[model samples]
Target: MRIRVDDLSGEATRSLIAHHLADMRATSPEESCHALDVDALREPAVTFWSAWDGDDLAGIAALKDLGAARGELKSMRVADAHRGRGVGRALLHHVMGAARARGLSTLWLETGTPPAFLAARRLYADEGFTECGPFGDYVNDPFSVFMMRLL
Candidate 1:
């Protein structure tokens, strides 16, 4: 699979990102969903990446600089057809590498607390991310599950 930093300008990448945001909105209340839209993910501090297999889009993920030696992982999503096929893991590993390449000493992420996110939480845990309090501009919210790892 080819994983490249994306500018969110391609039709396929944008559609997949929109799908990810829509799912996040559907799973969590508006105030609690922290998933970024394509345009938001394109901010100067953020680096978005899309994974592809030949001509097909497999997944997408992003990393946002949070100042200090910190970075935040954002918008990780594997296509429904690509779920459980190591897409999320591969995308996450790629993001972590990017974070390290940028000299980040810590990486954090915010995910939902619902049962729909159990597998996601497990994935983070398996990657050595421990549960943590809200970082950055995030507040304390029971619906939010925050995780972080030192690079």
Candidate 2:
């Protein structure tokens, strides 16, 4: 799979991002959702990437600079067809590599605390992330679980 910086306006990437946003909204209410939409992903402080196999979009991930050698992982998702195919791992490794390259010392994320998100939580834990308190604009919410990895 090829992982490359994404143009928010790219058709395939945009569609994948839209699907990710919709999925997040469906599983977690808007108030507790932390996934960014295309416009927010385009922010200067955030670096977004899309994974592809040939011309097919496989998945996407983004890292948001949080200062003090910290970063936030956002909008990580693998296409439904690509689920269980390691696309998510590849995207995650890519993001972590980018974060390290950018001199980040920690990477963090907020995911749903619902049964539907159990797999995601497990994935994060397997990748060396540990449960943590809320950071940034986030506040404790029953619907959210925070995780972090010290790089």
Candidate 3:
């Protein structure tokens, strides 16, 4: 698989992001859904990436520079066809390495607590992320699980 920075312009990337957003909304309450849309992911502070397998998109992920030596992981999704193929882990390690290279000391993320999100939560835990209180603009929400990892 080839992992590269994405400008959020390709049809496959846009479609995947749309699917991710829709899935998040369908799985969680509107108020508890924090997934970003295409425009939001295009923000200057965020860097998006797409993992590709030949002509197919394998997955997508993003890293947000939170300033002050901290960063946030966002929009991590492994395409259905690529699940269990290490795409998620590869994207995660790529983002983590980018954060560390940027001199960030920590990484943060917010995911849902529903059964549908079990794999994601487990992946984070396995990667050394531990539960934490809400950070940044987030507030307490029973449906949201916040996690943090030192880089």
What range of 10 consecutive residues in model 3 has the weakest lDDT sum? 18-27
State TM-scores per candidate: 0.97, 0.97, 0.99
Q: What is the C-alpha lDDT of each candidate?
A: 0.92, 0.92, 0.96
Decide which is better by TM-score, 2 or 3.
3
Query: Which of the numbered candidates is closest to the native, going by highest TM-score?
Result: 3
Clashing pairs in 1: none
- Angstrom error of the Cα, residue 46, model 2: value is 0.3
lDDT of 1 by residue, 63-119 (tens): 999999899999998888888989899999999999999999999999999998998
Q: TM-score of model 1 relative to the true fold?
A: 0.97
* lDDT score, candidate 3, position 56: 98
Candidate 2 ranges with C-alpha deviation above 4 Å = none
Model 3, 47-118: lDDT tens digits are: 999999999999999999999999999999999999999999999999999999999999999999999999
Root-mean-square deviation of Cα positions for candidate 2 versus the true structure, in angstroms: 0.8
RMSD of each: 0.7, 0.8, 0.6
At residue 29, give the lDDT of candidate 3: 93
**lDDT-superior candidate, 1 or 3:** 3
lDDT (Cα, 0-100) at 30 in candidate 1: 97
